[model samples]
Target chain A: MNSDHHVILRVVSKALIPVIALFGFYVQFHGDFGPGGGFQAGVIMAVAIILYSLIFGIAAAMRAITPGFVRGLAALGFLLFAGVGVWALIQGGDYLDYDALLGEEPGGHHGQHLGIMLVELGVLFAVSGSLVSIFYAFAGRVSEIRDEDW
Target chain B: MLEFILERGNYWAIIGLMMIGLYIAFAATNLIKRLVGLGLFQTSIILFYISLSRIDGGTAPILYGADLESGHGDSEGVEAVAEAGHGVADAAHSGAGELVNIYSNPLPHVLMLTAIVVGVATLAVGLAIVVRIREAYGTVESDEVQEMDLSVALAEAVDEVGETQAASGAGAI
Candidate 1:
């Protein structure tokens, strides 16, 4: 459907999408060491996908990553966080106790760091999946409503 | 009042933004405008809180390599563990020479980040509701919606009145 689009828009998106995704990954992994965190990173990732959808059409976007998969990812993200907390509890530590996982580590902060990073990954999945799914819902509904209704 | 305004100009501007946003959100008829206004209102509140957290020349709440307590000595609303690495804490703990204090609060920024996420989620729900309303009502205008309800109510009332009148007329005949 987007076959007739301007060459510049496609070219720019092709170059920019990878860069945006890379930045998002950086934010996700190196958040605590730097300024940004999972939330910003998730939004950035969602924006990259959305830009792709806008340029390549919803059908193509859906083919790449289906809405059902996005919804599952959102649920999985929440579950991942909850599972981590439960694991801490099972290990005879307080809920969300990162120290319990790597108590043997020297200086102790490394364990905390690892726990935070894992939790941030959960946050990234939840935010990005929800965002993309929301976009999909809106895009799908557009055809259901007529122009005159507005 | 003049002194308050002059001394707290940033506060006054923040208040102005809040008032404008509230007016637009509550008084405007267009749904999209209301959404925009709500966004503005949220932004103003975030700005207000962020401004509250700032100190004249304070640094970030971290000390790069120095291990300090997670709490600051005297700064309120700021868990500035590493602000300037130790002068203020040393002064407070040792009760030695007085030093100039400069550390901005980091708590408000932390809180506002969560607030921003919640705000976006709320806006998404609101827009979804607006879309559904438009689908069912064919318009999103507040007045139009009210007018439609009023007309429906009037018609229902008329129907009840006519039914009662017809029953009484038949009984008299």
Candidate 2:
């Protein structure tokens, strides 16, 4: 976990993490027209954090993202998703009826687009938060195994 | 027989992978190895679902011609088509009543995306449990943990039997 020993890894990961995060954002937003989506984007984003933790050590990663924050993020994402569905219900349509989301003409494409985007954003948040937290839970454990053990 | 096997080779490979995964899961005494086997099984199932979505000479399920023409290469073309009074389904068919594009089914692919995420979560939870087990029992082997549990149970049973015997002896006195 010592940063001094992994000079090359530290330098390379520092350079790559931002780009990986940017790509995750692109996938999250452009999911409507592409092969990528919330799940892919979420995993990609989580990988960046996991890589950071692996190279820089778990304490540094936890400092950067805190367990409490990630837990909140997961809850917030679920709320955003369910809130959208509830919004549709309040609009007098069936649950998750994206057409009712924007008060546009029933079955309008715009509402569907907006609803899908919001829902995917929620999924992105939930997936990334949950994954990073799970990584934290594992990394936070006290280990008797050392680098020599590998 | 050769042609038939060649044509359906993917299925054969899937079956092989599935059997390997199943064998590992059932036979491996190490908890981590069992989890790895479970992951392999999940991967093979994902591959199977993907193969089910494939169509001969089919491209992705997206609409192409109009979008290709726009040069912007965005979802605008889809909206434009809808605005032009063609329902999304109608656009896939030409006026000659023949299919212009054969698109692979996207449903299975979409469903499998959820499956993959669920599989990862399952793996993570399983690993966390294994880590806890290792911490508590000092080993990741399932047989070792079970043996330890059996010894503890036998010790507890002996203690209870001795205590009961002492109580009976006191009553007799």
Candidate 3:
């Protein structure tokens, strides 16, 4: 299929995609009060990449967002989160108990926030990379038409 | 009153967009169309989050310099007022006169960022599955693919029965 190279539309998408990404960042950092947080921001960022892939080809996108690397990264992200929870268990606390990681008092809050941040990062990694992986799975398949010829 | 109408009107527009997305998802038969529907549905969610974040006339929640001008009449809409005890007063303080209840809430914007990322990932996965299915069946259309699958299944079943009969004949011989 011929690719769409509509200059105006392309230009608009180019300009808007970054703006959307920046907006996601803004939401991510400022979500304490606003309606957003890491979850929503990650999705937006993924969409931006997906749109880029759609405009360009999947191969080009894979070059930009390596499917293999991302799959590993997604696994790593989950592992990191699970690791944190396990660490808490070792610290004489229940699973995912932030306070156990740190001592009592204000330290607990700090540990909690830190734990949450790490968890959020894990979420970001798994979510964003997995999303890319999913895209690669379908987009990367070899067609049956090729098989019929063989 | 005009501002109220405009605000509400924008909300309605967002709702309309959501409905359109839902319609696309439900009405389409092609797998790609369904993916498109999913995208529309997700986009509507982003819109909903953004729309809900708008407090009438609020500025973006980023705190500028300390002199950041103060508030107007206790606007019913603007509610993120800085408490008096906290010495670090935000834009909501300074002087109530300078305030304009139009600031943007940073929270929704942040959350939407993650949501958008997730949405893209979902789209990528869905499209990838569609592509793979197309590869396997030689077609991307839903009904045709189903028809092809049914025939293939029938053929497989016949092959299994034939294999069983052949084993029985071999034993009898």
Candidate 4:
């Protein structure tokens, strides 16, 4: 597919894909102090994958991150998020009571910070996985209509 | 009248966008067009919430004192200028003696972020369903899909009636 046409597209996208993914990670982690968060970061990361698939092909993209793996990521993320809440419950606090999860003091910021980070990480995984899988579902269909048909 | 209209220009824009979106969602025959309309409507609502969060002389919800001082050296001069400007405005508005840091409300912004995510997911699901519909009916037009469904239902009713008549005839024999 990369042999002939869209040479410029292929080259530019190849260079840009890593940079885009890096920016996604930056957004994910720096979200605590800035405007970005898990949702924005996840979408940005998913865009990198989607862009690659658009330039290369779905088959190549799937090879890098298979459907099964994507589904597992989504499930794992949900579990991670719920796990935090459940952990708080087990520690004799109300559900999602992050203060009990960490810190010696009842209302310390440490526990809250840790809880938010874990939850955001979970959201990041779930959102990115779901988006990529949705893209795959749309693109993997047989007998695609040509652009001119539209 | 002009002053009133110009002062509320952001709201006017939002209303215009919302109406356009609603019109497309109701009047468009193409399924894709309807989804596009829904997206536009969602976007307008998001814009409205963001606009509501704005304060006349407020900065972002983040604390600018410690972080700004420690992180960027150049931003100190900018921050000082902004503080000076705000001080003047504050004096004019409320006869201020103490410096007050006004920050825009962050709650609406956070809620809208979640709304935006939900909107994307909804749009994705809607488009996926539309794709399946097109595959099954070979068309994405709402009217055509309804017509095809009506025809299929009619055919099924005719078949049932024919079977009943044939059974009655066989019983008579």
Candidate 3, residue B166: lDDT: 100
Q: Which pairs of residues have clashing backbones in candidate 2?
A: none
lDDT of 3 by residue, B1-173 (tens): 99999768977888898888899888777989878887888888898888898777566776444424331233211332323333323433444445334467878877877577656656766776777787677677888998988999999999999999999999999
Question: How far does residue A113 in candidate 3 sit from its true spot (Å)?
Answer: 5.7
Question: Over all chains combined, what TM-score does candidate 3 have?
Answer: 0.55
Over the stretch A13-114, how does candidate 3's per-residue lDDT look in tens digits? 788878887986786666554455556666677778888877767888889878888888889889989988998899888899987777543212567777
Q: Write the per-residue lDDT of candidate 4 for residues A46-137, one digit (tens) a residue.
A: 99999999989899999998999998988898899999999888877889989788633422357888999999999999999999998999
Candidate 4 Cα outliers beyond 4 Å, as residue runs? A144-150, B1-3, B66-99, B170-173
Candidates in order, TM-scores: namely: 0.83, 0.88, 0.55, 0.85
Clashing pairs in 4: none
Q: What is the lDDT of residue A77 in candidate 3?
A: 80
**Residue-wise lDDT of candidate 4 within B71-135, one digit each (tens)?**
34333443454466654343333332223477898999889989999889989999999988998
lDDT of each: 0.81, 0.86, 0.72, 0.86
* Candidate 1: segments with Cα more than 4 A from true spot: A1-5, A103-107, A143-150, B1-6, B65-103, B164-173
Q: Per-residue error at A29 for model 1, in Å?
A: 1.0
- Name the TM-score of candidate 1: 0.83
Which TM-score does chain B of candidate 2 obtain? 0.80
Once model 3 is optimally superposed onto the true structure by TM-score, how far is the C-alpha of residue A32 displaced, in angstroms? 10
